[model samples]
Structure formats: C-alpha cells, structure tokens
Target chain A: MSRAALLVLADGRFPAGGHAHSGGAEAAVKAGRVSGAGSLEEFCRGRLHTAGLVAASLAAGAVLGLDPVELDGAADARTPSPALRTAARRLGRQLMRAARATWPSAELDALAREFPKGAHQPVVLGLAARAAGLGAEDAAYCAVYESVSGPASATVRLLSLDPFDATGVLARLAPDLDRVAHQAVEAARCALVNGVDALPAASAPLLEISAEVHAAWPVRLFAS
Target chain B: MHLDHNHTHDGPPAVSADAHRPDGRRRALRIGLGGPVGSGKTATVAALCKALRDELSLAVVTNDIYTREDAEFLLREAVLPPERITAVETGACPHTAIRDDISANLEAVEDLEDEIGPLDLILVESGGDNLTATFSKGLVDAQIFVIDVAGGDDIPRKGGPGVTTADLLVVNKTDLAPHVGSDLGRMAADAKAQRAELPVVFQSLRAEGGVKDVAEWVRGQLAAWVA
Candidate 1:
C-alpha cells in the first residue's frame, strides 16, 4: 500500500465538502458547550469515543472489502437524527465525487451509480482508501481523526478560539484517536466474519439532537 | 490515470468542469461573481439574471457567508424562478467554498443541471468577502470582481487577485461616486494599469442602463462558449 495516499485522503484541503459542515460544533458552540479550549477538549473527547468510533468502524469495514451498500444501510440504522442522516448522505455524495476523481475505480463508480445522491461518508471514505491501496487500519485512522479534527478546526472558526489551543486539543486527543482507530479495526474484522452488525453502533444523542436543531436554524454558518 | 480502470461504467463523471455531459450535450457556461462585502455581488447576479432570463436558460448558485440572505434576496426580487436558484452555506469562509473546497458549490450547480437541465448559463455568486477572494477555474469559466466606488476608489489600485486576474472588474454604484468622494477617472486608470487589457465596467444599477454592459459581456462569453 502506498502510505502517502493516506496523507492525501486525510488532508483538510481535499475538497470533499467537509469545510461547509461543522459536525455539530456550531450547535455546541451556540449552546455554550464548547466555549474555550478546555470545554472544546471535553466535547471532542465525547465525540471521539462515540461518533468517532462508529464512523471509524464503518470506514474500516469498507476498506476490508465489505459490501459498501450494506455498510451504508448499517450507517443509516446507526444514525438516529434525520438531519444528520441527510448531512451524511450529502457529504458522502460529495466525497464520492472527489474520490472518484482522485482514485478512480470500478468499485467506486458502481457505488456512485447505486447511490447517486450518496451512501454515508464513512463508506465512501473506506472505498476511497481502498482505491488508494490503503488498509483497514489506515481508513479507520482517517475516519477517527476526521471526527475530532473537523470539530476542532470548526470551533476555532465558530468561537474564535485560539488556533494554537485547538491544535493542542487535537494533540492531546492523539492517544484517544489511536485507541478508537484500533478498536474500530477490530470491530471491522468482527464484521468481516459476522456481518456489518458487528460494527460499533456508538451514538451521540446530543449530537443528533443538536444537529437537528442546527439544521432548522434559518440563519447559521455551517450547513449542519 | 484515474479514469483508466473505470472506462466501462456509464455513470455520472466525477469531475464537474467538463464542457459536455455524459449524454454528449454541451453544459452551461458558469460565470462567477465575487467581491467585498456590500459591494453589490448579489445585485449584479440578480440584474444579470433579469437581463438574460429571456434569451438564455440560466440558473444561479449563491454562497452565503452565514444566512441564505443572497438567495433570499434573489427570490424576493423574483429575478428567476424559485427552482432556478440554489444557495450554499459557506461555514463563515466564503472564499474557501468558492476557491479551496468547491465541492458544495459543484454539487449545487450539478444538481441545478440535473433538475432543470440544458441551461445556457449558471452564475455562481460568492458571498461578500475580501479582495483576495476569486473563483477557482475549476468552478467558473469566467469571473467578475465587483467593487463599488462607495467601498473606495483605491480598491483597483490595491490590486489583489480579484482586481488583477478576474475576467471582468466592475466598478459599481457609479452614481454614488461623487457622494462618496471617489474619483472614477483615477479608478479606471488604476484598473487599466492593474489589469492591462482585461475588461472593466463602471455601472450604476440605479442608472438608466442597469447591468447592460455586464449582460453584454456575458452574452459575448456565451457566444464564444457555444461557438
């Protein structure tokens, strides 16, 4: 596997539409849940263990050659909020377009045709990783890292939190990110044996609720 | 190299800048309008739509910094049918949405085509931002940077990417030039110095010939595109 491809996929500037969504951070910031770096760290930690773990597992499974369509459905079943589901699919579709252009494959094209709208972002992420010749662990790491990094950078923009402090938040979460990626790969292996239900169904009810609220905002910065 | 292995499938192409769709029909000419906050980007888009809607099948995609205000404005004005306009939330970084990560805008434009197809033009309007902001070539075929005399006549003299590289630079609200203490002659001279041979239009939407020169430039671009 080309290890360099992982960097390409993980880049914040990959142009897959992640810049427009805050991963519920907008709602969290408005609710005063993530005011400064300390609270931002707490919010990211909670997110890392729950939503991060689930997304990582989904991405890892996709890298393991699991059926992406079924994986997409599994993603839908795990996400409770209707608004979040819509965001996931939209982001997934955007990611699919970027991935196909970056690392075109018959598998990706087939998946794109199947879900023209989208198929959950983690599923597309894993397929993109696979197409780039990356492994399940790499895909998991990318997914896990993204779950926190998105919120951290967005919080910097949302609250004008010090960029250094936000980077420190991400740095402090490195061990947690490693653990989540490891756990995700393990769950993905279990799914490879026993189907996608073996993957983690970790949910953040607050994130779901806040996402719904954020979606309804007549005036807001991020899309979700 | 990316397209090598995927030759057989008949699916939507991954890249969005292609001149032709999968069915072999020419796609719409996408023009971007970008400028500083309150420089009249939205007004230009609305005026362009109103001027060209009769002759062209046109649509618009708006990148609003915080709210759907620009899209709401176009809708409120009834310049185009509601279905022909779409808004993209920029997450407080309008420049990023148009230049760095244009996926959302691309999706918006493609969705417009998929839904209301065979369009002749699509105007992608960026949220009011700094002078550094310009549309990516991947996003728009041509770009217009709008700066009004009210903002400052020295903007062209400032010579950022928007002023120097845009296909067309528009000095808007010319009627307010005297009121705002801006020198239109010096502004034009500085713009010519900065842009060399590129086109610049001094327009006043409140004036008798509103958006005429811009509409004509767009028509010329469309003619070249369809040629």
Candidate 2:
C-alpha cells in the first residue's frame, strides 16, 4: 500500500463534510469540560479510548474485508445517541460522494446503492481507503487520528485557545493514538476470525448525552 | 492501479454538478446569492420568491453562520411554504460551506429536488460573510454577489472575488445611499470598471418593483439553463 494514500485520506481538508462537525467537542466546551490545552488533551484522550477505539475497530474491520452493512449495524449499536447516528449517516453520505469522485471503486458504488441515505462514516472511510490502495492499519490510523484531531481543532475555534497549543496537544497524544490504532487492528483481526461481534464496543456516555443536547441548540457553531 | 477503471455506475450521479437526475430529467437551475452581513440578502430572497413563486416552482437553501434566522424569516414572511426552505449550518465558515467544501449544500439542494422537485429554480443564499466569500461553481450554476451602499461606496473598487467574479453584482439599498452619503454614480462606474461585461443591479427592496430587475435576470438565467 502507498504510504501517501493515508495522508490524503487523513487530511482534514479532504472535503468529506467533516468540517461542519466538532465530534462532540462543542458540547464539551459549552459544558465547561474543556477549557485550555490541558483540559482539551484530557477530553481528546478520553474520546480516543472510547468512541475512537470503536470507530477505529469498525474501520479496520471494513478494510479487512468484513461486510460493511454489518459493520454499519455494529457502529449504530455502539453509538448510543440518536443525534450522533444522524450525524454519522450524514457524514457517511457526504463521504460517499467525495470517495466516488476521488477513488471511484465499484465497492464504494455498491455501498452507495445499499445505503442511499448513508452507511456509518468510518465504514465509508475504510472502503475509501481500500479503494485508494491502503491497508487495514491505515484505515485504523485514520479513524483514531480523526477522533482526536477533530476535537483539538474545534477547541481552537470554541475557546479561542492558541492554535499552537492545540497542535501541541495532538503532538503530545501521538503515543496514545499509535496504541489505540494497534489495538483496533488487533481487534479487527480477531473479528475476521470470529465475527463482527469481536470488535470493541467502548462507549463514552457523556459524549453521547452531550451530543443529544447539542443537536437541539437553536444557535450553535458546530453541527455535532 | 484501480483508479484507471471507468466510473460508469447504475445509481444516481455522485457529483452534484450533473444537470440531470437519476430518472434522466433536468434538475433545477441553482443560483447562489452571497454578500456581507446586513446586505439585504434575505430580503432580496424573500422579494424574489414573492415575485417568482406564482410563475415558477422554486425552493431555497440558506447557509446561516449560526442561527436559522434567515430560514425563519422566510418562513415568517410566508414567502413560500415552510417545506420549500432549508437551512444548512455553516460551522462559522460560510465560505467553506459554499466554496471549498460544498457537500452539505449539495445534499440540501439534492434533498430539495428529491422532496419538492422538478423545480424551475433553487436559490442558495450564503451566510453573510466578508468580501472574499463566493459560491462554488459545482454548487450553483450562476452566482449573485450582493453589496449595499451602506457598506461602502468603494467596495466595487476594492474588488474581491465576490465583487469582481460573480455572475451578477447587486448594489442593494439604493434608497439608503442618500442618507448614508454614498455615491451611486461612482459605485456604478467602479462596478463597470471591475466587471467589464458582467451585469449589475441597483435596487431598494422597499421601493415598488424593487426586485423586478434582479428577478428578470434570474428568469433569463433559467431560460438559458433550460435551453
């Protein structure tokens, strides 16, 4: 697999409609759970371990040739908030459009036909990676990185925190990202041997609860 | 290696720029309106809807920076049925939603077509932003950049992308020019200099038939699109 494919897939500016979402960071910021770099790091770390792990495992499973339809069901089962589910499907649909234009895989086209509304976003991301000649590990890395990167950048906007400090927070969390990606890949391998049930189902209850509240806000910066 | 394969598919087109829908009928003519804050964009949209609704089937998609204020205003005014208007959250960057990353706007327009479709026109109004904001060509066939005399008479001279590159440059709030001490003649001349052959419309929606000229421009665009 080309190493550069991972960079293209992971770039925040890939134009897959991820910019409109804060990945639950907007809620954390508003709830006073995240303030500066220190608190932001804590929030990202928690997200990386729970929602990040689950999303990464799902993505890795998809790249491992696991059925995306079932993986999408697994994703829905892991994500407790109805609002987050809607956001995931919306992001999935948008990502499908971008992926079909960029990579143009028959598999991606089939998935698009299957889920006209959307599949889960991580599932689409993994299929996009496969279409781009990337591996399961690359897909997992993409998911885990996005999990932390989203909230870090969002905090820069939400708190007016120094951009450099946000970068520092991400840089400091590199080891954790690597560990989570490794764990996710191992889980995906296990799932291939057993079934989709072997994937992690880590849950972040506050993130789920806050996402529900954020979706109803009449006025807010981020979508979720 | 797989990238060399043909993209022929059996489902709806992935790209939003396709003029035809899944069933092979031409889609609506999409027009985007972008301008600075308080530049009468929503008012112009309301007026245009009021002017054209009886004759054409139209829907609106608003990219509001934070609130659904623009959509609510259109609904409150009863410009069209509540179902005819949709608002897209811009995450504080209106330009990104319309220009750099248009996935959200594309989905909104496609949804409009799927639900209230075979429509003649779809008006996409950008959130009030700076002079640099403009709609992506993929998102809209034609774009109108709005500026008010109250903003500055010299905006045309300043000449950003929106002022210089839009299909139509509208100088709104012409009635306020006198009170605001803005020179319409100079604004017009500067606009002529910046836009060579592109069209410009100056109007105050408070006046009788204020949106008529702009509405006619839209009608011409629709005629060309359908042709």
Candidate 3:
C-alpha cells in the first residue's frame, strides 16, 4: 500500500472521532488499575494481547473477504460491556465514513448501509484495509495500532507526561505491534484453512468492569 | 517494487506519518466545549461560529462518538465553511479524547490550521459526555461547560467540577424553562453559589440569536489573548 494510504489510516487526525474515547484506559485509571507509564504499558500490553489480538484477527479475516455480518457478531460476543460495544460500533461507523470517502468501495458502502448502527471498529477497519489494497499484515497492523495507540496517547495527555517520553513509549511498543500483526494473520489463515466460523476469542473482564464504573462517575476526564 | 522475501518491507520507503509537521508554535487556540449529552453544546458551537466567524479566522472540530451528526448539523446550518469544520468519530466515550488522550483532537485542530492556514480559534465540540466530562488542558486552551434547563433545574446544585471550574459555565435553554418546569431563578442561584466568582451566562439559544451573549464572552477571551 502507498505510504499516503498508511498515513491516512493511522493518522490520529483522521475524521473518525477517536478523540472522544480512552479505549478503557480511563476506566482502568479510575479503578486504580493503571496508574503510571509502566502500569499503563502493562494494561495496554494486556489489551493488545487479548482484545487487540481479537481485533487484529478479525481485521485480517475482513481483509481476506470474510462475511462482515459474521465478523460483527463475533466482535459483539467478545465485547461484553454494553458501553464498550456501543463505542465500538460508533467508531466503526465514523471510520466507514472516512474510509468510504478516501477509498471508495462497494463492499464498504454496502456494509455501512446494511449495518447503520452498531458495526464494530475491527469489521469496518478490515473492510477498509481490503479496499485500500493493504495485505492482511498491514490490516492487522493498522487495527492493533488504532486500538492501543488511542489509549496510550490518551494516558500521556491525561497524566501530562512529557511528549518526547510518550513517543518513546510508543516506539518501544513497535516490536509488539509486529508480533500481534503476525499472530492475527496466522489466526486468519488458520480460520480460512480450518473452515472455522469462530475468530480468536480474547477479552479482558477487568476492562469491562472499569468501563461500567467509569460511566457512573460524577466527575471524570474521559467519557468511558 | 519487488516484495522482500522477509515480512519487512523493502519496497518504497514508508512515509513517516508525523514527518515534516508544521511548526507547532503558530497553531490556533484549540478550545474544547464539552458537557452532558444534548446540553446545547452543538448549538453553542454553531452560534459561536455564526457570531464570531467574520471577526476571527476560525475552524471547528467536533467529536461525535458514533455519527457525524453534530458536524452534519453545523454543515447544514452553514455555521462555518464545510472545509473549516471536521468531525472526529470517537467510537466511544466522548470524554476520553477531550481529557484522557487528546492526540486525535490535537491532530484534528492542527490539521485544520495546516489546511486553512492560521486560525484565531478552533472550537472542538465533544460528544455529550456525563456531568464530569472535562477537556484535558493539554488539548484546549480554554473550556466551556454547558447545561440546559431542560435536563434539570437542579443540575446546577449538583455542582460537579465541570459546573464549577470550567473557564465559563453556560446555562443554556432558558426559553424552555417555563415549558420544562425548570426554576430559572433557583438554577442561577445554585450556579452562582457553587461557582463563587466564576462567570456564568443564562441564555435561550433559540430566542436571543442563540449565541450573542456567549459570542461576546468569547470575544472578550480572544481580546485577552491578544493583550
């Protein structure tokens, strides 16, 4: 894929309203689960391994032209929190709008029309990757990057960390990004070869709990 | 370009997404307006732009968790030029981007300034967050907390930080007070009691050209900035 394409997909500036979310980090922070950079890193790493892994795998499946309805169901099942689920669909819809505009494709438009509300981010990202002509690995990379980067970036702003130091943390996670991408592609390949309808199941129960608690706070920095 | 045997790319060089970024010094004052869901935040933003756009070069960034509904609303109203307005679909949790991780919001503001050239103000409208939703100081220079009389007359008495500490507290929808059974006097008293010396404005966006009073306040802030 062209570098411009990759930039558009990963640029935090994209019109996909990712700014309004903490990716569960806010909830984790309020619950005393994630305090500092190290704890934040650990929390994000866990998400990358669990939810991030699932998102990557599903995105890979999408790149391989799997059914979006099936993918949507699978994603819904993995996300137990109604708040988180609602969030994912909202993000997915926004991503679809930008993705459709930048990289027009019939499949994406059809998916957007079919599931107007409640489409998960991974499903739409996968379709976008396919439309952008990115390979499964790149698709997986973008998915994981989007998932983790938002929270990691949010933590920096929330905590008022040095911007340079924050970038260093992101740089350190580069290796993990590669690892998760490879794992996603492998999972996608396995699903294809084995004819399994199920995608990889990896979810964090604690994140869901935190999200719910965060939702009820009288004063909070992040939405959820 | 020949694909490398290994997974690493050997084709064209990967474009650094953050490369050659514009000078950070000359950016506009990114202001985030956040409050409860449907607290007239969108209405406030639209009114502000309509009132202030001619005086100052402006752009807007709106965060709508699932839809571009707010952005679309502004576009439909023609509050600002289409190119000057951008929406960030936050996916979920409107407070996160405004307060927790502001990269996306920051980037959006910067991108607008980059495309539109130097802007005096960039208003970022957050998706309706709860009473607690506040913008991270890192993302915005000033913040506004909005509440409508229709949500509840006692909302001011609740006295969350957003109601108390935001640069300004806007008591919107006063015109609806009679219809909604909200006590305008009690709300104003509660807000003044809780806010102490902080300023508050009660206006009916539907009636008073919606944004005139708040627009004047914004002008005062901008004047102070220049001073």
Model 1 accuracy (lDDT, Cα): 0.92
Query: How close is every model to the real structure, measured as TM-score?
Result: 0.97, 0.97, 0.55
Q: Estimate, for each residue in A15-88, the C-alpha lDDT of model 2 and write its tens digit.
A: 88888889999999989999899999999999999999999999999999999999999999998899999999
lDDT of 1 by residue, A1-224 (tens): 98789999999999999988898899999998989999999999999999999999999999998999999999999999999999999999989988988998989988988998888999999999999999999999999999999999999999988999999999999999999999999999999999998889988899999998889999998998
lDDT of 1 by residue, B63-97 (tens): 98999899999999999999999999988899999
Which residue pairs clash within candidate 2?
Answer: none
Q: Each candidate: RMSD to true structure?
A: 2.7, 3.4, 14.6
Query: How high is the lDDT of residue B193 in model 1?
Result: 99
Query: How much does candidate 3 score in TM-score?
Result: 0.55
- What lDDT does each candidate get? 0.92, 0.93, 0.78
TM-score of the A-chain for all models: 0.99, 0.99, 0.94
> Which 10 consecutive residues of model 2 chain A have the lowest summed lDDT?
A109-118
Q: List where candidate 3 sits over 4 angstroms from the true fold.
A: B1-227
| Best candidate, lDDT | 2
TM-score: the better of candidates 2 and 3? 2
